[model samples]
Target: MTPDLFGRHRAVLPDWLALYYEDPLEITHGEGRHVWDAAGNKYLDFFGGILTTMTAHALPEVAKAVGEQAGRILHSSTLYLNRPMVELAERVACLSGIPDARVFFTTSGTEANDTALLLATAYRRSNTILAMRNSYHGRSFSAVGVTGNRGWSPTSLSPLQTLYVHGGVRTRGPYAHLDDREFTDACVDDLKDLLGHTRAPAALIAEPVQGVGGFTSPPDGLYAAFREVLHERDILWIADEVQTGWGRTGEHFWGWQAHGQNGPPDIVTFAKGIGNGMSVGGVVARAEIMNCLDANSISTFGGTQVTMAAGLANLAYLLEHDLQGNARRVGGLLLERLRAVAARVPHVREVRGRGLMIGVELTRPGSDEAAPEAASAVLEEARAGGLLIGKGGGHDTSALRIAPPMSLTVAEAEEGAAILERALRSV
Candidate 1:
């Protein structure tokens, strides 16, 4: 049965589209943290569909809201009044730190980033963009152009003249040997030198934690230091919070708050988890910049009422239950457990991340060389043990990514960690 489905998929889908596992299972349904494959195998989901299922799978409140909204109205273009869309925008604007903030919704993170690029370029009057090394923003042309990771970026041609900068992944770069303070100082110096060498860029776009780059991050205030340099030159700062937003990191509501010395960013783009599992993405920026586009514009299916309704319900649930606090508490415990598990594993290179967004990088024993084979082995073993996880990294995809739902419980964390420990040991 799996082979027949795989054959059909390969015949219809693009070859570049990738799937997990040696024999991929068709996930039939999910409830809370557990999902059942077509073969009637139940597995605990740790990756949460690339962190898109922020709250949980089949959340009753979100499902009810979506159903109700769909029954009344499916979609209404930007030409008409959309109450749900307006309400969600207002809520997001109030939460966004940007002063005089305005929100624009899109259908996916890629479109949100595309809109951000459009706004930054139009506002600053330059097509040049600054991005970090080993970053993965999206799959769009503009997003790919700015991506410093060669694995995800398939083409060199781009509409924007993107200049890749230093200091996204601190452990693998030239300044990895330095202490945290020295690392930030070196990255700042590099940024200043790069600025001096190039034309004034429209914006510097970056992910707070490079999700696909093994969840790697720099020192907390590194971006704040760079912000000081960018501010002097009137270059905009664009934060791509698709994977790091909505308190996924546990410590802060927004990842940028970790580097809040320079105040809020000029523009912020978000998607993935905002709508729980629904398709909702958007950009929030000061009105002056959001309205900088001279020509009139509208996203045809961007803020359809159904998706907005789902988003509103999901956001309300997250806030009312204080899921951010839950994430901090549970994710803290989970990180400690994973760190303990990593210590006994010979190939585990590093265990890092905040809150629920954790990463365990696998490398050759006693060396920094990435061990992609070990990662693949662990992934397959975890599945055999009834636990589902994710794999990603710029260094040959050797990191095990474990970003479960924000509402994960302590018991679930322990259960998942036990399974992961066995998987690690087996490899």
Candidate 2:
């Protein structure tokens, strides 16, 4: 391919495709917490390729593993078993605190979520699934059906059954506050009312920490209440940890730990960081629920040798380096620094999140409504200053998501925060 060929093609691409190319930097390479654009300019990568490159780009261990695996065997039909697949599943199960958990792998987060939803529906023999408002599961038909966001309205894949519930509104500033007992109770009451009026749901799917919906944390006791309700209804709880798992939250290996919930969920979906940017996603389900599906339902590319090798190497890197612990320490420092910066910048409505999954809410100086345009401006300014950031939240898009690699150092965190502060000031 010619050097200009890709750029020329991108220029003529439809607007629908153009939306995916909004990033100011055209990345050619990356390492640790930095990336180089096509122009050879280096930029600090705070977004981590939408929070998927946990170990950073071109990690030596992961690349080496992928290379070795590719040299030996690249693909294997699902009908046949592979050593890498078995090792990957064993490692994921061991880290997930579910030793006997059966894993169903896929090529992306959406596929993993779709598989989990399928299992939930099949096992319960029910058509309806209750999902939280503002939650983002994935783009597949079933995933989108349960995704509370209305922006995915034009999807054609229809689900057997789907229901919506008001999870909780943003209670405090840019952050959704679920810290109080009353707030927790009110959320539970709302869920109860929704269930009372609708058919019993086959499963309840939720992001342990809302990733796309402004990085909101659930109410203090909300998860426990949710568990109780779902158990009472005999419905499974599907924890969609695509964005919040693999120690991104710092304290725990998963975001569910921050919720203080009891026991593990029946089904958990993971992607993004699991393979450190390699195309790998999977459902870690309770053995019983996993057995509900026949082998014929599996994906051909799921758990491919190459992807499995990458996943294994990524996990080994995370554990050996104690990246989770680093995330916690650096995340706390970043939050503290961000809070200070927010206090000075009137446009910054709030700073919220756990560990490295932080969000900065932007609004007009004295306005209550989200200033999505202002947020976009800030993002642009940050990009010009050599930092890559991302926007999240509902349609408002007023929340700036900061999810650096787990390998990010305190110095890098400070540098990213400094760029953000400068952006806010310039805006």
Give stretches of model 2 more than 4 Å off: 1-7, 10-14, 18-24, 172-179
Q: Taking the tens digit of each residue's C-alpha lDDT, what string does model 2 give over 1-427?
A: 2347567767887544423224534578999899988888888999988899998888999999999989999998688878889988888887776547988889999999998888998889887888877778887777877777665444735765667665434554323454467676767787888888878788988897788888876655577788898898898888898999999999889877655466788888999998998999999988889998665664689889999999999999998999999989999999999999999998988898878899998888987678988888888889888888888877687899999998988889889889999999998
Local distance difference test, candidate 1 = 0.93
In the range 319-360, model 1's lDDT, one tens digit per residue, is 999888989999999999999999999999999999999999
Candidate 2 residue 378 C-alpha distance from true site, Å: 0.9
TM-score, cand. 2 vs. native? 0.94
Error of 2 at 274 (Å): 1.2
Candidate topping lDDT: 1
Least accurate 10 contiguous residues by lDDT in model 1: 164-173
